[model samples]
Target: MKQRIVWILLGFMVFMSSVVMAAPAENAAPGSRIKDLLAEWRKGDVKPATGNRLPGKVGLVWQPRLDDATDMSEAERIDCINVVSPCWFRISSEDGTMSHAALSPDKDYVKKAQKKGYKVWALVSNSFDPDMTHRLLANPAGMKRAIDEIMQAVKKYDLDGINLDFENIEEEDRDALSGFISRLGTELHKENKTFSVDVTFPGGSPNWSLCYDRGAIAAAADYVMVMAYDEHPGGSKYAGSVASIGWVENGVQAMLREVPAEKLVLGMPLYSRIWKESDGVVEDVETLWMEDADRLVREKKLARVWDADAGQYYFEYQKNGQLCRVWQENARSIALKASLISKYDLAGAALWRRGFETADVWPVLAAELENSQR
Candidate 1:
């Protein structure tokens, strides 16, 4: 009888510990943290007001390839921010595990952006390594270690926030992913820092795209940025718009079911894809900046045709018997996307990468932002 009673006590203790572990952190306010942040921002506690900035929130993803000598200089990077006047800048300079990650923050760049009244957030990605992401998310200890390193980096760099961009994760890590975001959000909120996440548009393949628990992530994060591009990514056999209007609309509708429109930041593509097809078979794909797309259009003297279905300009030319097609993203398409922000009452739009856009698109973006505010 004594042994049986002791066994029962151990079982009860285990159950209690499990329950404790499963509960959210004491400081976590999943559903209301973003509301609080916005309220504080409105009170002018976060940063001083600026006239050139957009009324609605806008963000730019900055992914600097360190190995490229031809990459934009610090001056150019700052100019891009000044031109766009985005409220948030997410720098993609860190990747991998807590101990093995690579962090390369350009102090001067950070200072310049901050001086321009932009809040800088450092992005931490899994480097698209599925195995590494699985290892980090599947284990509780690993998650804590990663969060510690991320928080340390956030403090070390004096960053305003962190953007969790863990991609290519296994389907099994869905709950783990939400838990990680919850814990991170709690910690960041304690410091009064923003915590945003980048999730692929829903209704895709299971492990690669649908791994995200969008509703849970929306609750935990200050902003759930839908990476709404890559509708016809490089690996795709078919050639099409990088992000068509129909695709984006469907994605937004699906996400709205899971995330509040106010918490959703529709990600817009600043680039387009050029496809080379031979005999109705796609041979190669190359990503082009807005400027490059225009130059290609001029060089080929290709006649522009409006694709009403895609809601963008389309151009096609044949070179060496290979069909070359370009789905251009100019002021019109960008303006349409910006209008969607107002149409759906979204948080705003986020541009994928900073340098890919042209100057002509900025004014259109600003105008649409003004309209959205009105």
Candidate 2:
């Protein structure tokens, strides 16, 4: 009888170990977590939650620096708007300052965009200058001056809103940063104008990502636009997709913890990165627009294969004694991302910058938007 009781206890211990091991780890990738959740859902171990299917709000960032030397014609601009059908256009028209701000809006482009039924919001940035951002956010006088200039520009340009794109700020200025956004949002709301902020993926390193107090800023702003690309940005030693589905999902989940889904916008990349590696070390990297990426694969006669793990098309070749790899972003990959917006009931999706996407993506996005409304 004693031997039998000891054996039973050992069996119970083994079963408990397996149960604990089967649970998802805290540091698991979003894709892994999703897979586990699906398994649980299949067994009816967990209840699935669904978000409301509201009409999706599409946004685009339009930077003048991306235009060609000859500039895009008004007709061309109108045609582009007709194709993408974005609800908001964040024009790169202003840069932040310590004493005052600079405003540069192309009246012609603004007039054309508004006539096409697009809400025009002036985008202000610190040009990713860390020092400038710290100064502007830290000093109370500087913040007031900057806000005054922004309001003046909004009135002068007859704009509908403002998009704050400040980057590379110091971690020490986190509180000040939130304060500035709060004040700006308060003033902008008074004028009946919308205010939005562009933030990077949460859970990043301290200085690079933790600079923005997402909870505070999201509470203050009308929309919190999360730049979900650059999972592997330029200058990184390793090479990977610009934004994999797993990385994006993880980012959205992280932000959702602090922000309401209605006030969140998931930013998508319309481009990919070409990494040049030699002997297992990445030597250089280049950005490729989706159209150009597709063309390159055909021109080089390289085989494109779907990477189930990354959830994107993969292509690699040897050039000049270096191994070149490209994680191509086509309609299919983007469509998957759009589906996430509906699944999470996010506010909407925003394209990184105008002009990098292929025409095929527009229809896919449109379908996703329609599906979301249902």
Candidate 3:
């Protein structure tokens, strides 16, 4: 998830039914053939997971910019982060066609990352549109086209796998969404590649929380990257840590009930929010990157104090009688969160984004996850 991909923009049903359809006779009528094929689609071709290539691995959610020279280079040199999931494909059409924006995904960057021993699991997103999602799911032809296109892209690019990052879905579509993931995971597994999904915290708004049938999704995909951030996102009643240690731990524990330890990856947020409050009323929430947070703290002359309970440095200052606050994510905070991977014996850790993290953060991740990653 990127800065633009706000965690606050909240967002599966579990319907398990099976049907049987007989194969069409040779030289059968065109209408009969179409009916038989549609029946087969409804029956579901759920395939077994191929298993994770790097179960205990470190991953980074990549937000591709014009120049990824720095990100690509760092990932190459850093041995800890074994997986690179680039934001690549998008569900662009109501008819389920993926949009190919000019150079949205830099193929050369993919090759470079792979050459350096990174397992490139290119990300496929829903663009956070629920109406479009409803139509895409309703149309069997559209759904088929989308899956075919995704599989084609993987084969064409020789990608190691896929990371499904669908957001802002309606609760009514839970079963439909589960079916989509099951089908996609099946196809991906047939190719002998990893399939994963990005999910929000368990108990939140209906758009983000209730829509995901976590247990069913886990049963389908090879891995599930639990986005443990956004505890206090923008437009919240109060300001708090983007990912407090306690809240993150709770989220991880909640996910573990549904997803297996080896099949779950903890997603860490690299950014924090700078909250401006007046008379205890929230005024504005500004998303802050690691370097930006450091600069703002110095410029505003805010005093930084350690919140042992939250396990993050808290900074607050009064400007013109307005209270400004930030729960800063630093190396210490990241180290504490990374420790959860080991504590819970989880699969590994994945940073929310690439460039948002300060250069110094990677070493902490490497150090903490060294034992966690087998």
Q: Which prediction has the highest TM-score against the true structure?
A: 3
At residue 230, what lDDT does model 1 achieve?
A: 92
lDDT of 2 at 346: 85
TM-score of each: 0.78, 0.78, 0.86
Write model 2 residue lDDT over 1-374, tens digit each, in one string.
99999999999999966666665443334454544533332221221122122233544444434345212223344321221222222212223342223433665656666776666776776667677666555344445667777788778767777778778878877777777777778778778777778899887876679988898888778788898888898988999998899988988999999999988977888899999999999999999998899889889998999997778999999999999999988889989988888889887777766677777887787777667657
Candidate with top lDDT is 3
lDDT of 3 by residue, 1-374 (tens): 57545543421011211111233222234464555544554444465656555745655655554354456634446667778887778998767789753236666767887888788888898889988987676556777788889999998888888989889888877777877888888889889998889998798888889989888888888889998888998879898998999999999889888889888889998999989999898888889999998998889777799998889999988877789899999888999999998899887888877778788998888888886755
Which residues of candidate 1, in runs, are more than 4 Å off? 1-56, 65-96, 99-103
Please give the distance, in angstroms, between residue 241's alpha carbon in candidate 2 and its true position after superposition. 0.7
Please write out the lDDT profile of model 1 over residues 1-374, one tens digit for every residue: 99999999999999976665555443334335433432332221222111122345654555544334223323334322322212222212222245333435665656665776667766767677677767655444455666777787767767777777778878877776777777777778767777778899887887668788888787777788898899998999999999889989998999999999877888889899989999889999899999899998888777999999998999998888899898888889988877888888887777776668787776787776666666
Clashing residue pairs in all predictions, respectively, total 0, 0, 7
> For residue 115, what is the lDDT in candidate 2?
76
Ranking by lDDT: 3, 2, 1
Quote the positional error of residue 175 for candidate 3 in Å.
Answer: 0.9
